[model samples]
Target: MKKLEIACFTIASIKIALENGANRIELCNQMEVGGTTPSHEMVTEAAKYDLLKYAMIRPRGGNFVYSTEEFESMKKSLLDLKEQAIDGFVFGLLTEDFQVDISKNKELIQLAHPLPCTFHRAFDQVIEVKQALEDCITCGFQNILTSGLKQTAIEGKEILQALIQQANNRITIMPGGGIRSSNIEELDRFVQANWYHSAAITDGSNTANAEEIQNLKQKLHA
Candidate 1:
């Protein structure tokens, strides 16, 4: 069966995602900053849910580019979380020129050690797509969550198709960004991935809205 993972920004939303049948959760602390590494408290708390949880390892918001200290801090964060009995971790790193920072990312991945690693949307910023894919494969990344260089996966379906074809089982390509129940059908029919990710939020501002969460799950299962 197809699998659906939900990107959750807070503890409340993580609970909502789990209650609604999301098979996995990508835990992040700050959604407004795109996403950042979650706290140890949050990670430990999430592990209790019995659902697959992957923590984001971004040190700060801004762009994927990082200073030397910031990159070192990310590695340290991974080392700290490696002791946690969690599923995996997600993050990405790039050079100031928008090229893949292979060395820095490799160091962070090593810090993650046994945990599976996912190269996040930072892959989108690389100037060369095919080269970046090959680099990710070479770096031992398990998956790549991208939108095929488009603002949204739907808008980039053709490129996504090509990317998936090129992947050829080398690594999983999980499309994210702008995914919702309204467009999931078309995505499911077109992408045909083993997994997909969506952020299900409510109409209101704060707190996880129970009704909207349930509605999203229903659509996913449908």
Candidate 2:
């Protein structure tokens, strides 16, 4: 059974996604810039839901690489959210050369301990996929949300399939980026992923579409 994870930016979006049977929410803000950490008020409000809510811990969105100060800021955000009902954390960091910051990511996984931690699409930034996957597993990240180093999941299906084989259940390789309800079934069958991700973006729209989410899940079961 393939599960759906939607990156929701608003309470309304969260409600729609959840009502439509999205298995989880990757909560964030500033989707135009990829995603930045959402406000405390937003997190507080979204945490009221019954579904699993994974807050984006990124302090900013330009790149995965961070300075010492930025790293500290990420930790601070995590600490602040620890007391909230937020279920888990999603974030990523890389070295100047696009290598996973093993030491820092280990710190991130540890800091978010006892809850699931996911290294986001920043996995696409890594030049060394095989080694980076091992690092993510070693660092205790529960999920790696990636597009298989491509701009979109459909474009990267071959690599996604290879990644799934390489992962072998050690860590979940969730195919995100440009996934839509219309194409999910095809990818679901070929990708063989138990987990899928999307923003539920519709034509001429930037906001999430509940109907699309419902349709996507329905297609998954079809």
Candidate 3:
């Protein structure tokens, strides 16, 4: 069956996501700036809940490229959160020229060992989607959250479909950016990805709308 994963910016959103039928959640903060790493306190609190959660490992939100200090900070954050109840890690590292930094990504995936890893939307910024997908697989990422290198999953559905075919079950191609219940069926009809992602923030707030989350889940099953 298809699964719905919600991008939750706050603790309140996580509760709503669980109660409303979400299969999993991408836990992070500052959705307005894409997503940054959540605080230790937030992760600690979120761990108390019974749900599959992947903590975002981004040090900051502007871009996927990181400075030496920022990269170290990401490592520290991953180690710290690994101790929490986080089920997996979500992160991406890119070269200055927009290629996947295979070595760096592999280091984190190894650190996250045993737990899965999802290379986040930074995949969209890659100059070559096909090659980047291969690099991510080499780095041992279990999933790649992308909009098919486009701004939204709907607009990128064609590419998303091609990606799914190319991946051939080597890794999961989870269409994420701008996914919603209204367009999910259409995207599924085209891309047929196993996983879909959304913030479910219909009211333009940081919190997720429970009804939207339910609708998304119900529609995915329907």
Winning model by lDDT:
3
Q: Estimate each model's TM-score.
A: 0.92, 0.97, 0.98
Q: Best to worst by TM-score, what's the order?
A: 3, 2, 1
lDDT of each: 0.80, 0.89, 0.92
Candidate 3 per-residue lDDT over residues 18-114, each given as its tens digit: 8998899999988888999997777877787898999999988788889999989999999989988999999999999999999999999999999
Model 1 alpha-carbon miss at residue 24, Å: 1.0
Who is ahead in TM-score, 1 or 2? 2
- Please identify model 3 stretches exceeding 4 Å from their true place: none
The model with the greater lDDT, 1 or 3, is 3
TM-score of 2: 0.97
Question: Considering lDDT, where higher is better, how would the candidates rank from best to worst?
Answer: 3, 2, 1
Worst 10 residues of 3 by lDDT: 39-48
Query: What's the lDDT for residue 162 in model 1?
Result: 78
Please identify model 1 stretches exceeding 4 Å from their true place.
204-222
The local distance difference test score of model 2 is: 0.89
Q: Which residue segments of model 2 deviate by more than 4 Å? A: none
> Once all C-alphas are superposed, what RMSD does model 1 give against the true structure?
1.8
